[model samples]
Target: MTALPDDLARALDDALDRVPASRLAPVVERLIGDYRGGVATVSSRQGPILRTDDDAAAYAAYRMPATYAAVHDGLSRAAEVVGRLAPRTLLDVGGGTGAAVWAASRLWPSLRAATVLEGSEPVIALGRRLATGADDAAVRAARWERTQLGAATTLPEADLITVSYVLGELPEPVRETLVDEAAARASTVAVFEPGTPAGYRRILAVRERLIAAGMGVAAPCPHDGACPITGDDWCHFAARVDRTSRHRSLKGGTLSHEDEKFAYVVATRAPGQHADNRVLRHPLQRKGLVTLRLCTGDGAIADRPVPRSRREHYRAARDTGWGDAWPPP
Candidate 1:
């Protein structure tokens, strides 16, 4: 629901100004290609993409805005399902440019302390510098730590932990370990990745792992039963953001906005009682009838139709948005 914060936008603009046109143009091109293809160029054997100031600036300019939008929507849904209890302490793993921290802080203003863990010093520096301009006192004072997160690492305890756009880079073994560590340390955990099938698969794996660890899903899923989705289809959602002129230029698109599709899961140690069916797609309204594709707690997909004759059901279906839990307020 929230766009990029104004302060954060200015910080990114400042970072972009520091980058030479020659240096920035190439990185932006490569970044656009990598992003469109759902490629993890940085996660490969060569290592992270943010090796220099130019790399950090270029990456931030091209990716941070969209990443922030996706995480912001994911966290907003988590808050809706888990009941608006703001956390005092927050942790962001693989917190490049501290985007997730900004999103979380914006979602829950009660946050008093925030910490970011990143492996690249260049990224940490850029993230810290950008964070310094944040309007939120907690975000501006966030602690940026440079550390590698692997199976053996111990995560600090916090009320909420967010891991966004970071899982695809790791080996399956390492991802398993990191999920375990995260589940062990936090009461609520939210993981987000690109909307690609691969990203959805990663989110699904983490969802199952967290459930096995006694955590319950708070959003996107109505129940812990095995995901009813199967075959070529995957579970994902979309959030639209206005494209800055610079963004349009870098991405080579004329559209004034872009829909950032993402896969995410928000799991809490204590599950909240809410709707038992999640609307899987936008309701198809036609000729006095509305049709909803739902993933029900019964562990199956149900296509239910509501004709105008059924006033309550029809109205509910007509108003339901994609990803909204059926019967939700």
Candidate 2:
């Protein structure tokens, strides 16, 4: 589970306080509709979805926590491999409201510099305001550049680059170009998307492009040959996000927490310690047996059952959760 830092959460709360939820509810609803209906076309001329300050506020209040949680989970997995590398800089493309920047700063305190590239003026304004309250100096001073994604776009060099929840909005060519540019510019790149079938497809495409760009798959996949997942299934994981009062109110939900299901891929110039097998889902525990669905190093999905007779392995299995590496690495 990943939760927003207290300072970041308070900053968001304070920002939301400036605008009443009652005034932002309809804007949030419209944004939700735009998300569901697809906000962008292949044409680069299409403007950003967030057109007003209220729209940006609604997004920051309602969507930032979930996006932050998802990006944090993805970055944690990446850190499992690249923690020792000690990345010192970050570049967040399409970083709406700096969610990815906050997640990165939370994971890698060594980060001394960060740059955010976003297209929307209102989104950038709100992002800059929220960043002023960030505890991480790098995040607070991050440069919010107004750059649109297209064929002619060039990415800045950084130790790490993150693209989250933005690829699905662009055309295929633009997405491919962005990934290729990131691969060329950064030592590590992490991309995140919603855990839908379509989102999974985008991630798969990104994984392929990254591999083709001479980078190694750093997390999720142990080997870089081919993805084992086939048919209707897709590779994704869930992060539990603790909702704030404002979050719940904006979302109109009673649940105190929500699971943010996400699909992501981390590729790096240098390979890290890849997991032997990744637990694919929540372990099913029976009276005396635990069943584990694993994606193995050889690119195959298998169900491994641990019975009580095997005390050591059973106990380990009992303690394991979804998205963990098997054998407790």
- What's the TM-score of every candidate structure? 0.94, 0.96
Q: In candidate 1, which residue ranges exceed 4 Å CA deviation?
A: 20-22, 35-44
Give the Cα error of residue 163 in candidate 2, in Å. 0.4
lDDT of 2: 0.87
Model 1, range 1-329, lDDT digits (tens) per residue? 44678998998887777776667878888766665664563354366656787777887887898889998887777777777557889999888888888988988988999999899898898998898788999899999999887778789998888898888877787788878888999988989998889899999999999999999888788888899889999999888887787878776789988888899998888657345788888889899999999998777999988899999878888888888888774
> What is the C-alpha lDDT profile of model 2 across 1-329, one tens digit per residue?
68789979988888888997789888888877777676643353366778789989998987899899989887787677655756799999999999999989988889999999998999999999999999999889999999888977889899999999999888888898899999999999999999988899999999999999989887777778788899999999999999877777777889999999989898888656477788999999999999999998888899999999999999999999988888776
Minimal lDDT window, size 10, model 2? 38-47
Off by over 4 Å in 2: 40-46
Q: Output the TM-score of candidate 2.
A: 0.96
Top candidate on TM-score is 2
For model 1 the TM-score comes to 0.94
